[model samples]
Target: MKLLINIVRWVARFLGIFLFLFFVWFAIEIGSPDLDMMSNQEVKLFIGNLIMLMGLIVVWKFEFIGCVLLIGGYIFFSLVNYSFWIGPIFPIFMIIGILHLFCWLADVFRIAKKISFSTRLFLK
Candidate 1:
């Protein structure tokens, strides 16, 4: 169980970083397209990527905030495009959210165990 938890946490982290870099690559590929000419899709792409990047960046120190932002971005895009949410991407987001919650629980349990162990030692 511990190993699975660690794997999930690491995979989520990797995905977050990968997605951030992929967004940068995508933005660069457009090569200074006219902002006024850009469509809603393009605008959403840029904004969503920026938000996700910010969320991922701070996730290291603030897990809940980061995960919520990450999942929220997914939800927002799903609603706007109405494409990914129905497809495989939905499962990916669901996995990430569940993994995040599990990671939080694992940390809390670990901390509680340590505190209990220390208290027991002190009492002895």
Candidate 2:
């Protein structure tokens, strides 16, 4: 189980890295947007994308926080765009966030179990 959890965590990390690079390349190809001329929706989309990217980068150090940022950013983007089914990319990122979440949870539980076991041993 621990091995499986580690595998999932590593997979999530790699996916996050790949997605981050892909987005960077995509943004470079698309060129920068004119902030002054962008509509409110466009601005929101830009911010959402920024948040998602930041999450991906931060996830390397903080899994739980990063997953929250990633999932929240994607949801914000979907809500602002009024299209939850925009494409597979957003959903795939969301899945990656979920995977990170589960890994974090597993680590948390494992730590808690060890602490409790030690406490019980001390008590006995």
Candidate 3:
């Protein structure tokens, strides 16, 4: 059980980091290439997003920031790249959301198990 929990947590953390970096890369692509073509506001917005997503990873609270970044990135990307807006990219957000979800799940399960164990011993 402990091993499984550890594995899940590790996998989740990796996915979280990967997705966050993906966001930063996408943002850079948008803000670069044709720097002169991109508006100042667009450059600022992309850079701001990159910084915040990286911060979320550094803070290790990938859920909140990851979810927001995923959704925001998808919508913004769709708007910017209207041609490639086919199929479902919501799954990307779902995957990141699941990673964050499992992290919380592990914490909740551990706490619950601890509480139950304590209750049984205390009652005896």
The candidate scoring highest on lDDT is 2
Better of 1 and 2 by lDDT: 2
Predicted candidate 3 versus true structure: per-residue lDDT over 10-43, tens digit per residue:
7756765675677668767775456578796667
Candidate 1 stretches with Cα past 4 Å from truth are: 32-35, 38-45, 83-94, 116-124
Give the Å shift of residue 14 in candidate 2.
1.3
- Per-residue alpha-carbon lDDT of model 1 for 21-82, expressed as tens digits? 76568779866667688799878865664565677776777887777776677767666666
Model 1 poorest ten-residue lDDT run: 85-94
Off by over 4 Å in 2: none
- Ranking 1 against 3 by TM-score, winner: 1
Model 2, CA-based lDDT: 0.91
* CA lDDT for candidate 3: 0.58
Overlapping backbone residue pairs in candidate 2 total 0
Model 2 Cα lDDT, one tens digit per residue, 41-82: 999999998999999988889889999998999899999999
Best by TM-score: 2
Cα displacement (Å) at residue 23, model 1: 1.6
lDDT of 2 at 80: 98
Native-to-model Cα distance after best TM-score fit, residue 89 in candidate 1, in Å: 5.8
Model 1: lDDT equals 0.71
- Between prediction 2 and prediction 3, which has the larger TM-score? 2
